[model samples]
Target chain A: MLLLSACGAREVVVQGNFPKPLMDPLPLTLGVIYTDEFAQHEIFDEAAGRAESDWLVKTGDAQVEFWNTLLNGMFQEVVQIKDSQTLEAYKNTVDAVIIPAVADLQYTIPLHTNIKIYEIWMKYRFKMVSLEDVHGNENGDLSIKPDQYFADWTLTAYGKTPTAFLQSDEEAVNLAAVVALRDAGANFATSFSRVPDIAAWMAEGLQPPPAEATDIQRLEND
Target chain B: MIRVIQGKLIAGLVLAMSILQGCVNATVDEMTFLEPTEGIGDASVVIIGRRHAPDYETEFDFIECIGDHIRRGDNSISVLHELDFINMMYPWFEPRTAPLRTDDIEKLLSQERVANRFEELKLEYMIWIDGSTIETNSSGSMTCGVGPGGAGCFGFGTWGNAADYEATIWDFTDEIEVGRISANTSGQSYMPAVVVPIPIIAPVQGTACDSLGDQLLKYLSAKM
Candidate 1:
């Protein structure tokens, strides 16, 4: 049993620190929902051939940590809700809610490619919903429901590293995963306001504060 | 007698080192667009690798080697590490969002945050390095076999390695490309085995790094 377990699969827990984006914050209280699957996401792949080994990659913790830091930097205020029920309780306090999920993930190894590189590709789905009318219950507690979604969009990211730099396959995969995550964060930070739906939503009342509004010192300290 | 023995040891060590090192041929080409009028002063600079290419990513160790060489060569210049500067600027220097041209840098600087950080670092120049060391050619092979009495190997193997790198210096203070330097190096490595394999490896990448680094230091330190 021990020998079998040893040969079963190679496991890699993605680990890396993500930097906060340098940008002016939007003036809005944002609510974020992290579903269980998204928070504990993992990928298991079976060996495709004799030259390959089964892989188990866990990137959930890094994803959660990265998004948390990025969103905090992108917005004036960010609230993390426990679940859907909790989101209802905080809906009145926030302008809108965003739910992020991992839509798909794929990877390639040097053994599979002619170039000595390891690559990882990730896709993310974001659902942005607006709050409906706020109502007070008998206890004076505010209740609100999620209304029409302001935006539902998908984002794709890619990362690759050369085998010459890394000594082991696990390390290469971990680095590639981190690179892809950073890429996704960069793409989202730079293109978020450009999304048509997001643009229209922000156009209603919120215009990103001018360049002077950004806190450069604070970002540098972070 | 003791002095003679120490001298002999030192001479033997030098001979061994020379024997172990393979032959390397290096060529460097440099062009300066804007000459510096004054010393670098208290201003700092960053050397970052370009990883936007689809086929290859510049080796981080090579970039570090160049930075180390420059720092060791000059004491007045401040060299910010590649990873630190990239992280300090965050998304702006990322592989996907990094500026591709000098004009793009102007656009990036227009962003107050990026410009603020650039000023905070006292950054005067940015060196964007791109290229990689590759195994260009290989010939011969080695076969090893073990016997019950003892293990022995007999064969020969040789491979050719080449490193091609280019460094583009961008003067952030002037918001223009100052100059470009390129280093090309190649060498042949050999491994011969009688009972045990003896490998004489070529320092192709190291040669390129040293050649490029020396030229960069001269350019940065030049006052005319």
Candidate 2:
């Protein structure tokens, strides 16, 4: 007889603690995005689509909420530097036409992980644009390009020797993703530093200095 | 007395070899479904759905079950067809009404006609699979080495439209089924495998495909 588990057999678990997202990029400005043939393909499957259009009237609303959460988790941090002015000015500068040209993060390559070993991988892409054009600046040239962005994650800890299992393999993997996400953010900061609005906005929204801590304890501690 | 003891020992050895031998042990566990259901939209059209398949090794135990079932005078094909979608032919082939129909004459899942080698063998029934446990283990780009477990590089993965598409296609509640699944696996490559510990409950009312070539072969093959 094939042995079945009464409670259901668990083949794998969260072997690694996924890194907690540092923070939400604030003063959020949604990117309108660029168009590409393959990259712009529909994101929904047949069954999911049918459940909305034909069967349920409110399906579209639920569907919209779902992707929003995914997109929300993608961009976790926006640190501000004192060099940037007010949040509104930073937001306007960040929303300037060029922001949409880059893909918003769908997922980040967590730190210290070799993406190759993963059974599941995630990635995203976008149409790049320039800020000078958003406000229709005289210097705007309407530069355009497809920016394909990718990050990798690995899920291992299966079939390792019993001795290997004795260690906390799962935590190791989770920590790796956290570090990797930070690395990817740093990468974005390095590349987009040229865009003053992007640089200024990113500084203000991504990471607040210890002095600017919003925690309730900070006020009491001081 | 010694000779009798030797006979008993030989019988036990034969039984052990038959019962104990089985497939390899490789388990995949875990699935991360990324997303927000919100913006997940329906595509304008669907040309085809894609799913991967498991390989022979991990499913070796099922094959052994087939072997035992056959040894027990079971004329049944005893197939562990591709997961979730089992379709086999014996009496006559009721292939799908599609451009890419399976011609018994062809030994392939593609076009161009030719007889399959197994034409002589009795094919009782095949399990049309919708779900599967197979995955490719090789890494690197598929061009060089193995692709994703879900991708077909090492042929180690299992994901077939058999589960979703076929489940709807072969509406079990309204349609007829011969037997209920006894034991199995379900879920992602890692956590997906499920086992129904109890004996399979045969369907109360079901339709058994009657075929001349396949049923006859099933009979003859079992005898052998």
Candidate 3:
């Protein structure tokens, strides 16, 4: 209800408080921003000796493929960060005005797998810092909520290592970005339109994919 | 007619599976082991030996060696999992202790091949690997002989250092562990092939650690 009211207020202001709310779509200022994947990334056990020579290319393709399967058309396109400066630009934009959510918020996970090795625990919330300029920040903010975004990583093998499991931390981050885009777009649309897919937009808020029920989880330290 | 062909194929597969049931089946038990807040050194870490693949027999030399070393020294030093499982009544090929206690067979059998580890030695919780480690056929340190490391495992030492073997452990955790280890053959170093003609390459020598068990007990004793 509160979000709906806020949406109503914002929509009114965007359209001069008139009511039709059919504003034209704007250009992307910051470009889609992703963190931690600044350099080469790996979603496999280094011990397995997987090559990263062409990792970014393969991963980018794989990520687009997964989102296309899960939520089509939610993004105009998926973009990767070219350099730290761009990332900084995106970050500045986000920090200047948009208050990203606290990912550090704790999540109490309950499980039935009786395995004591995996104790039920909580995760500290983490907040996303945008890596865009002020305009870029507006582009991301005007489009999506970072918290609702989902990312995923696919594993090369099924086993003990956290990356050994099916989806990896990097992949999870990518999934989050896609979901964020979906939510951001939905928020923008709902301000003017009354489409029902808002529920679908919200569904991406699911917890990090659990380690393969086969016992594979990441951050062994946590 | 097509249905009949499909049925025939299905029946053939079932018949073949009956003959090859052993090959067709594997029971997979899922596990989740979260790291303790405490780092490796503070606690006596227990790394349950995972069963690789195909090898039905259990190997005990490594565990025995660790236990002996842990027992011989510091209280903060002594390790609980070792040759205390050895059966003294009968002496055989390995000269070390038995891989597992015969009395514990029913307990062990009830569970699919598993390395149930009490990670922190903390009585409150335990952790088990939900991943697989490759089996090897080489050895290093004091008990340097070459054979199946475990089911599908290839014993390491035939070529690399203990750090090399760490690769197997790392493969199970995505760089969750980042330190390195180096050790020498411990307790009574004997030339691997003194009289035998085929020489081992890495010289199962002592510049590394002390005795095999003591060295392993000391080193592996502190991993994340």
**B115-144 per-residue lDDT for model 1 (tens digits):** 899889999989999999999989887788
How accurate locally, in lDDT, is each candidate?
A: 0.83, 0.26, 0.27
Model 2 spans with C-alpha error above 4 angstroms: A1-22, A41-71, A74-94, A97-197, A200-222, B1-224
| Poorest lDDT segment (10 consecutive residues) of candidate 2 chain A | A154-163
- DockQ of each two-chain model: 0.65, 0.01, 0.00
Q: What local lDDT does model 1 show for residue B147? A: 83
DockQ of 1: 0.65
Residue B90 shift from truth in candidate 3, angstroms: 26
CA error at residue A192 for candidate 3, angstroms:
52
Q: What does DockQ come to for candidate 2? A: 0.01
RMSD of 3: 25.8
Q: Please give each candidate's TM-score.
A: 0.87, 0.20, 0.19
lDDT of 2 by residue, A97-204 (tens): 212111221221212133322122123232223322222113322122222111112211111111122333333333333322333333332244344434554566
TM-score, chain A, per candidate? Answer: 0.80, 0.25, 0.21
For model 3, the chain A TM-score is 0.21
Error of 3 at A98 (Å): 61
